[model samples]
Target: MLRYSLMRLGIFAGCFLALWGLVYVGALPRGLGDSNLLWVLLLSLVISAPLSFVLLRKQRDSMSVEIVEKVDRAKGRLQDNRTREDAV
Candidate 1:
C-alpha cells in the first residue's frame, strides 16, 4: 500500500512537471494570459490528482485480491499438514 501510494505520488508529480514545462516552453497555448495559464495549470493538477488516485486505488485493489488468494492457499496447505500430522 505504501509503495502504491508513493508510485501514484511520483506519477502525479511527473505529470504536473511535464505539463508545466510544456506551458513554459510554449508547447501549449496560454489560456488567455499569465493568470489564465496559471489557472489552467492549477485546474489540470486538480483533475489529474484525483484521476491518478482512483487509478492507484484500482491497482491496489487488484493487488489485494492477489495477496488474499495466496494467503488462502497457504492456509489450506497449513491445514492439510496439520491433518496429516494428526493422522500419524
Candidate 2:
C-alpha cells in the first residue's frame, strides 16, 4: 500500500515538475497574475489522476489484496479467541 501511495505521489510530482517547466518556458499558458502557482498545481493534479489510475493499476490491485489478507487474518484470530473462550 505504501509503495502504491509513493508511486502515485511520484507520478504527481513528475507531472507538476513537467507542467511547471512548460509554463516557465511559455509553451503552456500561465494562470492570471497571482494564481500562477495555483493553476499549475491544479492542472498537475488533474493530469496525474488519470495517469496514476492507468499506470498504477497493478500496484493498486496488490494493495487491495494485502488489505483483504489482513482483514481475513484478523477475522480468523477473532474466531479462534471466541472458540477458546467458549471452551473455558
Candidate 3:
C-alpha cells in the first residue's frame, strides 16, 4: 500500500512537471521571452494543486475502504471458525 501510494504520487508529480514544462515552452514567443509567463505558470499550479489533492484524496479513501472490507471479511471467517469449534 505504501509503495502504491508512493508510485501514485510520483506519477502525479512527474505529469505535473511535464505539463508545466510544455506550457512554458509553448508560451515562449518567437523573438522574445515574456516574464508574465511565470505568473501564468504559477496560477496554473495553484489551481491544479488543490484539484489534484481532492482527486487523490478521493482515490485514497476508496482504497482504504476496500482494505477495511477485506479485513472485515477475514474477521468474519475467523469468528465462524471459532463458532464451529465450540459446537463440535
> Against the true structure, what is each candidate's TM-score?
0.47, 0.93, 0.46
Candidate 1 C-alpha lDDT tens digits along 34-71 = 57557555866786787786778878887799889999
RMSD of each: 7.2, 1.0, 8.0
Q: What is the Å distance of residue 83 in model 1 from its true position?
A: 0.1
lDDT of 2 by residue, 30-84 (tens): 9898999999999999999999999999999989999999999999999999999
Q: Return the TM-score for candidate 3, rounded to 2 decimals.
A: 0.46
Residues 3-77, model 3: lDDT tens digits: 547746665566557656766587633223564546554555665666667667867777789899999999999
Residue pairs whose backbone atoms clash in candidate 2: none
- For each candidate, the alpha-carbon lDDT, in order, equals 0.77, 0.96, 0.67
Query: Which pairs, if any, clash in model 1?
Result: none
Which scores better on lDDT, 2 or 3? 2
Choose the strongest candidate by lDDT. 2
> Where does candidate 1 stray beyond 4 Å?
1-52
In candidate 3, where is summed lDDT lowest over 10 consecutive residues? 28-37
With candidate 3 superimposed using the best TM-score fit, by how many Å does residue 25's alpha carbon deviate from the native?
12
lDDT over C-alpha atoms for residue 8 of model 1: 76
